[model samples]
Target: MTIPIALTIAGSDSSGGAGIQADLKSFAALGVYGASVITALTAQNTRGVTGIHQVPADFVTAQINAVFADLEVRAVKIGMVAELAVIDAIAAGLTRWLPKHIVLDPVMVATSGDRLLAAEAVEGLRTKLIPRASLITPNLPEAAALLNEPLAAGEAAIESQGRRLLAMGCPAVLIKGGHGQGAESIDYLVRDSGVIALAAPRIATRNTHGTGCSLSSAIAAGLAKGEDMETAVRYAKAWVSAAIAAADRLGVGHGHGPIHHFHRFY
Candidate 1:
């Protein structure tokens, strides 16, 4: 039996908190073969992003080609698209390879409140990438970007928002409710069949920097291993919840930091 392959197209987190680093960590933790195409390299830490260096669009394409030409990648997760051209490059690569599943985590604002994607890239991502996604995972602010509406204050404040996102073209949508002011982190998954909601108590910690990226990547890893969507999400939610609970209080920042992924096994 061969190990299933999974690809993560995103940025690099120097602190190993978010973007490609976090995705790779989640994939390895989940026992999937992980590969990365770094879109941008950020001088980031738990404190925040101080500067960013975007890989040239052509190099990004080269990285994609290098991976797909050699590996039987089964699923892809896209995040931290630093520029419109990078997003276009990914779309072009997918146009040819057409992997079995694509999960788009519309990562716009960082946990530290730094802008990761250019303002112009949002529209391009919607038209070029969202439709290609088997699952589009967006938190409250990201849903607002997709819908062009003010964010719903909480989960109850936004009913059918996932349905609205599904209508936009993605076959399925997962609207994350972690950022919602609440005692629980409830995520609503909406598809043609109906809505499936999962709720768990929110941990009282700030080490949640890569929670979204980790969740989406674990889902992609699940898909690569041929798990159904619901099963993938169920496993991913449980995985991320465990990761969050085991977070390290190591950094001094107003915002949260990364978790200890291997705490249990180590």
Candidate 2:
């Protein structure tokens, strides 16, 4: 049987709880073949990030080309792009290869309060990369950063920001409400058609290190398997919720452990 394939273009988390590792796990768990292009090497764990080494823009391009040269990369998920040059490289590669589904996760910060994206690169992300994406998954702060505004306060404000983000050139925006304060984590999937609110009960667990990466990759996996945007987002939300709920079962790290990406297995 031929399996659908998804690609992740992101950083490497030495801890194996986030970034490329998490993306691959999410793809496999969702029954998709996975490929990767590593953009950065991060010395990070559940607690925080201590060091980062960026891969040269040319090498990043090489990796991207190598993957697209052979693999049937149906969908792509991008995460933790830390430099302007790397962003440009990824954008150029995408233009050349043209993956059908692009899920851009504007991963700016780690769960343990470490900045992942550089301040100067944010502009590149806004102008060069965001437009090329099939969907952008940005949390509250990320959305605000993209808009050069304060964090949106309520659902109304959040939806408003999502709509404004759409004007930036992407066809759809998923303003994630995981950062919001509530018993329910509601994500707003705003398209030109309308807004879809996907809600899941917030599971109280510190093991949310790779939640965003996993969620975005899961969406990519679904899209690779031929599911539409809304269906993919809804399925990802439910799957992530279950993973978070089962997270406590795994005794991994000292803080902010990874969600059980294969929670359904054992």
Candidate 3:
């Protein structure tokens, strides 16, 4: 039987709520085979990240090479690149492989208010990685960091931020409104053609630790299965919403718990 494969290049969250672990789980939940290239490893839990150890950039490149040489990677979800070297390495690897669907989740901070990406690496991500991605999924803070402006407030400003990101060279941009104050969560998808707004009722829960990672990976899975950008994003948003709705039941961690990735299965 033929199986669809998706790749995640990110960090390792020991808590298993975010980063590579969450990405792999999302891929599996969506019925897509998952491959991973870990950029860094963190000693972390639900409470917070205590320490971090970055994998060598060359080693990251080797992992990418091995994956692309053997597996037919249908889509790639990139997250939590901590250093400039790692970003450069990932950019080089992507350029070499030229994967069909690239989902760049610009993971800058952890839910525990810990910064994941180095401040100096932001330029590398903006210049080297952003241009290569098919889509970039950035939350309010991340988007603001990229653009060097305050978080866009409300629908109109959010749409403008999305357009600004698109102007930065990424073919498409999804500006997530999860951080906004509202009864509903609104996400804007801006492309060269136009913008598509996605809204879902907000689910109040602390179990949203890995949400960004999960959503981006889910989108990659949808793309791997041959869905269009809009369709993939729509399905992914729905999947994440369901996961969030079911998250409170887990009760795994004391701080921000993880969403139920396999909520549909069990």
Q: How big is the positional error of residue 77 in model 2, measured in Å on the Cα after superposition?
A: 0.6
83-162 per-residue lDDT for model 3 (tens digits): 99999999999999999999999999999999998999999988999999999999999999999999888788888888
Whole-model lDDT, model 1: 0.89
* Candidate 2 local lDDT, 73-143, one digit each (tens): 99999999999999999999999999999999999999999999999999999999999999999999999
How far residue 52's Cα lies from its native spot in candidate 3, in Å, is: 0.6
Residue pairs of candidate 1 with colliding backbone atoms: none
lDDT winner:
2
Residue 188: error of model 2 in Å? 0.4
Q: What's the lDDT for residue 5 in model 2? A: 94
As a TM-score, model 2 comes out at: 0.99
Candidate 2 residues lying further than 4 Å off, grouped into runs, are none
Each model's lDDT: 0.89, 0.95, 0.95
Candidate 1 residues 1-266, lDDT tens each? Answer: 89999999999998888899899989999989999999999998888899999899999999999999999999999999979999899999999999999999999989999989888998988889988899999998889877898887755545567888887688999999987877888898889998888888889888988889999999999999999999999999988988888885455355577876665576
Pairs clashing within candidate 3: none
* Shift in Å, residue 136, candidate 2: 0.3
Q: TM-score of each candidate?
A: 0.96, 0.99, 0.99
